[model samples]
Target: MKPEFENTPLVKAGKRFEIEIDGHFAFIDYREMGHQIALVHTETDPELAGTGAATAVVEKTLAYIEENGKKLLPFCPYVFAYIKKHPDWKRIVDERFEGYNKL
Candidate 1:
């Protein structure tokens, strides 16, 4: 992820986190719930698909969550799987989340 995008949420785009790469935007839609962020969807432009844009955005989102002293609820399947594959991310997950242990 680029340094500029590490914490850039496209306010004009409904508060979703965004990464603009090569004119394409990859985004993760989320909802904030008190101290937790519910990551709901991740999408990459058709042109950015398969180019690791989703993964990059996910990483940045996780980092943002941790940096801000919050936890996450991985409602997005991609984010759940990413946490499963990279267990270190689980540390910042909301333990009360139903799927926390699975991650």
Candidate 2:
């Protein structure tokens, strides 16, 4: 059998963006590099596994970056994949690392 998951909004706090689900927090860590935001990592509570919390956090993070006129340096694989799946967000991706999209 398969499990079900839910999508929740993410909150930005300092250098990380987080989403709370099932009493646990799913978060993405990042670092600012000049005109870009380097997405360093993404993690979710085990209880939230298979849930869409990570995606929600990433979506919000991307929106925040774009809204603030910042580009994305998707060092995290999950963030890279999310951007690949949603090409509309590609506009915020750093062109210097365009090679990553091929991976």
Candidate 3:
């Protein structure tokens, strides 16, 4: 089963992006520091929750980061939790975004 999201854009940069999907769009804002990608925000429509949209967006985002040979500062809680769930991705996670590490 899937949601009715199949033609939406994810991560637009000045009207362009490294990836795009359909139906529902995933919004992500970023800042570059040296060679790292600071993921400022990530969100999908509320109606798209639990429909694999989040994971798809995260995966696409990660792929972009990898292709660019950059690290990630996952500021978005959703991406942070996704990182936790996929520990293999820990290597790409910039320590600066680990705000809860000290707590």
lDDT of each: 0.84, 0.80, 0.66
- Residue 48 miss distance in model 1 (angstroms): 0.4
Query: Runs in model 1 with CA error above 4 Å?
Result: 1-13
Per candidate, the number of residue pairs that clash is: 0, 0, 7
Tens digits of per-residue lDDT for model 3, 1-103: 1343334434547522333444545556677788888877776677666667667777777777877889888877877888777887777776666563621
Model 2 C-alpha lDDT per residue in residues 25-98, reported as the tens digit of each score: 88999999888899999998888777677777788788889999998899899998888878888898888875
* Model 2 steric clash pairs: none
Q: Per-residue error at 29 for model 3, in Å?
A: 1.9
Best by lDDT: 1
Lowest lDDT block of 10, candidate 2 = 1-10
Lowest-sum lDDT 10-residue window in model 1? 4-13
Q: Candidates ranked by lDDT, best first?
A: 1, 2, 3
Pairs with backbone N, CA or C atoms under 3 Å apart (clashes), candidate 3: 6-22, 6-23, 7-22, 7-23, 8-21, 8-22, 8-23
Q: Each candidate's TM vs. the true structure?
A: 0.87, 0.82, 0.70
Query: Model 2: how far is 30 from its true place, Å?
Result: 0.4
TM-score of predicted structure 2:
0.82
